[model samples]
Target: QVTFSHCVPTIVQMLLNAKAAQGTDFKGWKITIGGSALTRGLYDQAKARGMNLIAAYGMSETCPLISGAHINDELLKADEDTRSTFHLKAGVPVVLVDAAIQAADGSFLPADGSSQGELVLRAPWLTQGYYNEPEKSEELWADGWLHTGDVAVIDEMANIEIRDRIKDVIKTGGEWLSSLTLEGLISRHEAVRDVAVVGVPDERWGERPFALVVLGEGRELSAAELQAFLEPAVAEGHINKWAIPQQIAVVSEIPKTSVGKLDKKRIRSEIARWQKEGSAEQTSLS
Candidate 1:
């Protein structure tokens, strides 16, 4: 009869793996995931282990409760897979929270699902300003909304799906590729125990995705194998062929921040250094 608990996706992954290893069932435990996006693969894994997961969106500046997934009768009628897709969204704004997307030009975007922009918020509980830091506070509260720095889309259902961090998006051939989306697709591979996808500077394309992967125990995978595995997704129009990483590194572990979020900055820096030093662990899929 335990109620829902809150955690980041990393904690959920660790718990799921540990409990499964110990032959323990989650007993239909409910977990509210925040701090980062929960991948579809992780959701599937948790469901298989008898865990119910819900995704949410917020930050320290907002008293940490901006939006949350809500299940309705219509949603309940959908298949588990379909429900999971909705469950993974950032969801409609919570009570007392006003959320909107702001374009680069400071105009509000429509809740059309396809219009992606920076998520902005205005809630009573949101922090007014940085303590004794007027300049920083002004920037944070610019245009009267708390900037979230998260690129997101709001569907007709008012479900807000975070596409990526504004800084982490990959710009290639004048199109944007979501590193989070790529990581989600890559996580579906059987051998990927842990993964991170980062955009690296490319002289030709402006930027290109690079993957760092950690394989499961007793599992082996190559860059070519991973590239081939993603081909079906490309054909299905889930991702563009150019979105595939031309190079991948099979690593013992992917870097994480002190708070357990993927450390993309560090990952990018490591890749740059590795490329300069010519690491033997790096593989060329192209």
Candidate 2:
């Protein structure tokens, strides 16, 4: 009975699960996904269910408007495979919003689609500061631009593709790994119902990626199985072998924030506690 909906990627995923359980037809649902990165795996699943899904980008600070997946005449005429390449991106900035990527050295990076850095914005509608929080406000608008805290890259067409959050990006073996990318790849597995990857402290590598996964009903998955599944991605140079999670635990649930985004902070604490108590299933490659 729903014609249109606007929600985060998590909500779209939940709706897909509901549709499967209820066996309902959603051939004409127009759903816009915002608030977080939309993975290709989720997009494919939603498409298979006949849901018309689109990706968007914004934050509470920007009056919740910035970019979206633009489907123009050419895009509309293209096949799903061709359309998804553009649809999965954050798209060009909306009118009045100037977007840029700032590197760690404070230099503005190029919009070459490969230079990843913190996404900064300048728009008339952006929030100026936190209420009664001068220090935080100052940080938010450092160098006269609102810092979004999201690491992203911009292509020649001005499309923005969010890579990962600054705090959540994993630094292992002197290379940065996008947790979002890892999760997206993991979610492609047929047995994976939900997945979250976090970087845990490691002595030799500085930090190692750990994954927590939830399997579909009556399905089973193991760390070895997942690594085997991801081998092709590594072979194809989508990710390095070291980027493969050193540990994976199948859990009944992955915690979520009030708004339904994955609660990575709580997940980190849970992993710590689980390791301390020897309850976590430790699956590591030799």
Query: Candidate 2, residue 128: CA error in Å?
Result: 0.7
Question: How many clashes does the backbone of model 2 have?
Answer: 0
- For candidate 2, the C-alpha RMSD (Å) to the true structure equals 3.0
Candidate 2, residues 154-191, lDDT tens digits: the string is 98879999999999999998888999999989989999
lDDT of 1 by residue, 1-286 (tens): 6558999999987876573455776776899999988988888888887889999988999888888998899999999878988899998898888888899899999999889899999888899989999998887888789998888989998999999998999989998899999999998897887788889889999999988888877899988999999999999998999999997888877778888899888888878888788773654221
Candidate 1 TM-score, true structure as reference:
0.94
Instruction: Write down the lDDT that model 1 would get.
Output: 0.87
Superposed Cα deviation of residue 103, candidate 1 (Å): 1.1
